[model samples]
Target chain A: MSPLLLILIFIVSTVVGYMIIKNVPSLLHTPLMSGMNALSGITVLGALTATAFALGTGSKILGYIAIVLAMINVAGGFTVTSKMLKMFKHKEVDNK
Target chain B: MSDILFYLLCGLLSVLVLVGISMMSKVEKAVKGNFLSTIAMAGAILLTLVYYDIISVTSLWIFMAIGLILGVIWGFKIKMIEMPQVVALLNGFGGIASALAATVIMIEPEQQNQDQLMFILVTASLALVVGVVTFTGSMIAAGKLQKVISQKPVIWKNHQWITGISLVLSILSIVMVAIDTKFLPISIIIGWVMGGFFGVAFTIRVGGADMPITISLLNSLSGVAGSIAGMASNNPLTVAIGGIVGASGLLLTQIMCRSMNRHLLDILLGKTTSTGHSKGVAVEASTVVTASDSEEDIVSDLASIIKSAKRVIIVPGYGMALAQAQHLVSQLSDSLEQNGALLDFAIHPVAGRMPGHMNVLLAEANISYEKLREMDDINPEFPNCDLAIVIGANDVINPAANTAEGTPIYGMPVLDVDKAKHIVICNFDLKPGYAGVDNPLYKMRNVTMKLGDAKDTVKELIDMLR
Candidate 1:
């Protein structure tokens, strides 16, 4: 694909993604966020793959940076999400 | 030109992926939501790289699929009960990812040009401050929620200076870390610790009544941090939408605080935490009056109550939050509707756990949002109402704010239910509301306190009307 085509693809995807999220009603935000926070954990893999690839191809600088960030994004996201779920702690919820 | 486009693509994908995951799990098992978002994010990143000729598709697939499976399992295990911790985790990761990105660029010797280096450095720094604060502060919040750390006020004698000095030091460290590495990391670490310290101090000191606002405040902070991540990545859409969440959440928290007459400084300083020992107390399961005569008891009293009444209003509070009695309240409203009586909801801004909490609860039971009235909107109507049924509500209905001269919740907005001709409070007890103050609304001459478990009480009242 041409460079312009790739950039266009990126832009279109981003817009499509943004519209999907932006349209949700305000009431759904917390639950949405709660769900997203858990999912954000996967961004670690993205960061890692991007970084590792960036590194593996001799772009050592961007590569290392990506790895460090990816790890933090992955690990940190999960930890925060685990903690978020604690606030709703109740006995009834537990039996579930 | 390509770098900018790449950054923009990455940014959009990040938000889109997160949003995609959010929708997939609405209120289903929360873990499922997190798993979906995580997998989507991981996939988006891999796809972006392959599109850019940065990475082969094979490795990206292998790595993320493993990640996808692990993340999904983890997401499923995390109960909704752990949501606050999850929020803290998100804030921490946003901060940490950026900080690490900055660290990578700073230590990089392979800089072909200064522009990329500068981009990385600034973004990393942004990440460091936000990440550290979020990471540490969220830990403190989690600790408080988990009871690992005391949630009681940590008011030192010199709290203002302590909070102030830490904040100033944090600002100073930003410049210091950028200029030299010797103390920057330590400073950043300290700043992170200070953020948590202050957050806990701020949160623990605030009364339990203000927990919803505290949750909202932290939520806003998390949103701001996410926007910063977007900016560091040169993503405008992330910054824009994140800013919306951050700003709106804070506004909601502020409105909730104001309606309660709570001062911002007081909440931060932990002033009210110790003073309101009466908060969170379960009201005794007793009533000043009971209707055992069933239909005859309600029917006999209904005619007189409805006959002399000019209007009738219903007050819903935390008890309603616990009982989930909104539909029942609507039923009661329908019964009164037959008597040619007017019925309205007396909604105090801070009536329940979260702002608009009662309204939200009622909306779930399919109550019309328009039928719910705000304190300012419906206070004038209380005087004309022949009956004000106080259902599981306390502080907002208390007349002491207007008549008792001095109450902790003085000047806070409330329904003038005391002004009505007949007041019936269906509460478990008169112990106090979350504020720990005696409600003179109970003592009104026309007030007849009907006590029982809220659900059963309302059900009995409904049976009588039938």
Candidate 2:
């Protein structure tokens, strides 16, 4: 597929995935987010695969760029997920 | 092309925002459960072409069908205590998917050329390690939560050695990635297993009182996994948002543990496995006065109390949720207003299982948000108020947190309900709560203990005022 087409596919799918996950109600949120979050790790795999292909195919610059981006993405997910978990820790200090 | 997608997406997303806002008024947590959120997500994605495409549609539909069947079966068969395990297991599935993504990329590095082998190696390794930890550790946590396995700490004198090894291995995995070495996979896998083992041992060994914290830690782990996955995928938004959540979660966990006088190592080492913390010496039962004699008597008594009180603070608890008594609670509040009692609801941060659990329940009852008071705002007034009505709350109002020496819940701030001239508590029974310790409030000379369902108890009180 052409780069344009690949970009469109990526954009569309990301948007779709975002929309689906966003709509989950509070009741289902904990589980849904927990589950979907794990699945989101696939982005790393995608980045890895894309990076290797790019570098091996002589697109060295693009490969390095993708790797850098992918690392940030992975780190961010862990950050946010951990933050959300903080909400559940030992019991909120209600400061009552 | 971009404009059309953008407009369509924006328009669709508005609906989700509106729906979320609509749900804000509900007091019952059940209103905001995952089921509704997932549905809204589906609607948003489909309309905006996020996951409405053919492949996504097919996959989603398959999951939906399977989910529907399982939900139906589980709802009818599972007990309340069993629900946590079920949720935990589901969480594991997500963890596994993330790990699998890492494996797939590792086995086939299509992005190696562009990102350099280093980036792919690093991102893939991080994803694999976190994903595996989330999956296996969550399963172990689910087992303990469900009581399918013992909730005791797995102690060996050399527990420190194991933890040290795991920490070293995890750090080494990161270093391996930094160096762009092929050993990245092997090191990360070992780290993954060790981390997961710690997570499991940590969860299983902690006693029941820390269920609230256990739930939070697991939640944070899942977010970290997402962030790691996002890195491998080169996604900025995921990294930004996910990192915020993960870091904050770890920070919150530390704060909570510290507030409870616990060290992070002890909590993670599963030192709390001994139920000894809550094994309070039984106070010989004291019989003072029954807060409620009969339904008719309570009604008569409630009318008088309503007539006498000026400002009343209401404290809600898990019993309120179990009774699904938001509506009745609202009705009672209204009746109190008519009787000239100024009423406000006090919300403790951890009043219910999840954050804002009580708030959600009160919102459902159509209790105005303005009437709700968080712990900080409402605590000061407790001593001065004519009456403090506690509905199904246990620990949040426990005086032990403030007074008892070496007590498990000591030093945590609690509502000084005992300071009130009159205090009334309603619950189904006198059974010890999740803390598994007898409440001293029930023995207080001034506080009146009313045992019954919150719904029925509140109704009787309302009728008394009328």
Candidate 3:
């Protein structure tokens, strides 16, 4: 990939992100942070590719560690945010 | 043809992710959309790897299985109280992932033939520094928020110099790696290790009071690191998601800083001193004194106040969560409503250690969202409120923010409970809040201090009202 194209992708996504995020309410900040953390977990793609093509033991080990860490972010981020949003769902009031 | 299809899929999935994030705050059943987008992201990653022939089907499946099991277990095991720290740790994990990926990619010998090798190396170096710093800094943040370590700012007079020097050293090592200079391996190690040290140094000086800003900022840093890592790997899928996360986290950090009325630089440099120390001294200098009322007297007095009051507002804080009193507080509100008094809840943005924390607890007790009012919306109603009951909340309801100067939280916005005809403050002790400043609201003439465990006191109040 050309450096120019990658920079273009980076710049465009950033502008798009700013527009979307500015609408989120203060009440959802924690969930929003966690959700973004999950998205950052996309490093798992690079980590997986790195491990599969690793030329040496050092690269292989680092790749494996990276995969594990990224998975934790991916899985934990989505799960936590989901649990939190569930609390926001209305519940029937028990007058007891 | 297959390669084209794979790239197309990745592009489509990236769009889905953007759409999911935008819908998350707007729609009901957002979790479902989030999961669908996550699946699409995972699919894009897998297909891209296959197109590159980096991993065969069997190996990819094995890695996916392992990753899934670990993720599910970690997610389910986290309790409600641990959510904030767990989120912090997740952010740290993302940072470590990017740093590790950048390191592995940098050590490869194939970069010599790449036309954009210089740009890739620079991006990799950026990832290495940012990722290392975020990883270590977030771990420290989680520790402080969870009380695994001291919640106070651990600062020395030379703290700024120490952080500045370490950061410089880290940058120099990264420069060596980026420029293909001598001692490559040693420089890489030094760069990341010093970056890690800088992370710890940057976080330790921030007390718990400013943790929301710290956590959000670290989240943003991890996103920036991930984006750089994406560029280093020449993967657009990672780049897109990383860019979105980076931008969103940055915006959220800005919003948090604006609400706190502090600059991003001031927070990072540890320049904003919260009168945490001076407030302790002010405790002695404070001339106004009042006798702490006993529980029995408080119950009797509160009962009469409730009887006469037509409108009441409740402001709950961390202490309420600590005592697990949301259920009782809910019942008390119901009792007030039954007595023909209109009851409302005022929720502070930073209340209960995280944003919307109080809301979750109250929602658990089946408190309607309609009855919950934000600080700005509820402030105007205080003037007409017959009684304002502050349960286990200190700093948010502290009158000092408005009336006192030179205090750490002096300019910060607070709930104007002072404007009410009567105020009842319930707390376990007279200690100042996380900011460690004296609360002048306790000394006000219309205020009554009811000291006890928040749950038991609220239950006692319920009994008295009955």
Candidate 4:
């Protein structure tokens, strides 16, 4: 994708996000924030590529650290969200 | 042909990911919605990486596998109560990753066409600044929230001027990069340093009471940085996700600001000052200071009152989290229900360190969301209630937010527990909450302070009730 097209998509998604998040009840805001925090960990994709294609030892080391950090964000974030969401069960249904 | 199919799949999954997050709140099966959306998002991200050939190298698999294992292990090892800290740290990691990715792009003198050079520099600079800021700021925030550092707002003279100058310099450095100046590498490093300073400078000055908003803002910043990074890398799907994360984070930040009755500017600029309680005296006429009350007397009194109350409301705070007492509270609530007293929970929006922190805790303890009423929904019902049991909560129940003016937390919306006919407070000490203001609600004639560990106090009450 071209940078221009990517920018357009970014703008559209920002608007879409604004509209969708407007209605989130305060009760769920914390989890929603965390869930999104996890989603933003998508930067792991960048880290993976950057590390793989790193030109030198310095960039390679930095890229490796970035990959580890981003991966932590992604894996930990999703697990935590799901765990928290799992606890949000209705009264009648005893999932635990 | 496969490329076309892959692009279509990415587009569809991107939409599903956004739709999945939005529907999480309304759906009956929120977990299922969250699950599907999370998976779709992961799928889309992975596919995009593969399609771009970013993850094609067989050697990269080892690093990827190791990183995933470490992350999953850390994630599962953490307790649910530490969700805020985990989220904060994760955001920090995202920020740092974006910064490092941008760093790699900036340092390498690779394929850059003249037409796109300016755009790339702009995006790279943005990713660097925002990412660095979020990284350092979130680390401080997570540490403070976890109480590894003092949660008090750290203020020093001449701080505001320092932050302003640093931010301006950072922006100037970014402009230098965009202008294709001689000091491009030097300018990039300056941007990162200044951005890091801004993050710490901004966060360290905010009091613990304002952490939720601060954390949310930083989280949003990480998203914005990721988006910028995506734009720089020419990844459309990543840009979209970044956009979604950033926008939603800002919206939540706005809501948090409103709940505190403070403007976003006030929070960001450190305009709000903590109204420290100089002396532990009751300022409100309605509040009559009671010499520190004994625990046994209050618990027994609470037992008798619970026996007679027709409706009871349990208001929880971070103290409940502190004492690790949600399960005990749930058990007590069940016993209360068994004893013919109707019970409901009133949760302040910013009750815990994180958003919805109390809700998750309560739900974990098997309390139904139906029984947990939001402040707006439950405040009016307090007047008719027999008793309001506040566990380790100070600021949220402080009537000063409602009736008092000129106090730092004056305009903040607090639980109307004072409206109840009787109130029982379970806390360890007479110490003020994160806001550092003595709670005027404590001195109310109807309020009883049961000073003890929340879990022990509540457990004893349960035994007595049984």
The models' CA-based lDDT, in order, is 0.55, 0.54, 0.79, 0.80
**Over the stretch B63-127, how does candidate 1's per-residue lDDT look in tens digits?**
44554454445545554334444455554554444444333333432431344434434444544
lDDT of 3 by residue, A1-87 (tens): 777888888899989988987876665666777788888889888777767766888887888888878887887788877776666
Q: Individual DockQ of the candidates?
A: 0.11, 0.06, 0.64, 0.67
lDDT of 3 at A8: 87
- Candidate 2 CAPRI classification by DockQ: incorrect
Q: In candidate 2, how many Å is residue B113 off?
A: 3.0
Mark the regions of model 2 whose C-alpha exceeds 4 Å error after superposition: A1-96, B1-94, B140-195, B251-263, B273-280, B285-303, B322-331, B428-440, B452-456
- Worst 10 contiguous positions by lDDT, candidate 3 chain B: B281-290
DockQ for model 2 equals 0.06
Which candidate achieves the best DockQ against the true structure?
4
Name the candidate, 1 or 3, with the larger TM-score value.
Answer: 3
Give the Å shift of residue B323 in candidate 3: 2.4
TM-score each candidate.
0.65, 0.64, 0.91, 0.92
Candidate 1 docking DockQ: 0.11
| Predicted complex 1: CAPRI docking category | incorrect
lDDT of 2 by residue, B1-466 (tens): 3555644553454344334323422323323432343344344334423321233434333433443354344434533323345445544544555555555555545433454556656765776667666677777777766667775555666766776677667666767767756665576566567656655545555654455455556555655665565556544333333343344335434544653456666677666623545543343323434433565665455557666898898888867876877778888888877778888888775665443445545654556656777677878888778888889888778887778766666676677787787888877776665544567888775566667778888887777676
lDDT tens digits by residue: candidate 1, A32-70: 444433332332332443354343343344434434434
Worst 10 residues of 4 chain A by lDDT: A87-96
Instruction: List, residue by residue over B252-361, the lDDT tens digit for candidate 4.
Output: 78877877777777777776545544454434422333454565666677678878888999999989888999999999898988889889999998888777778888
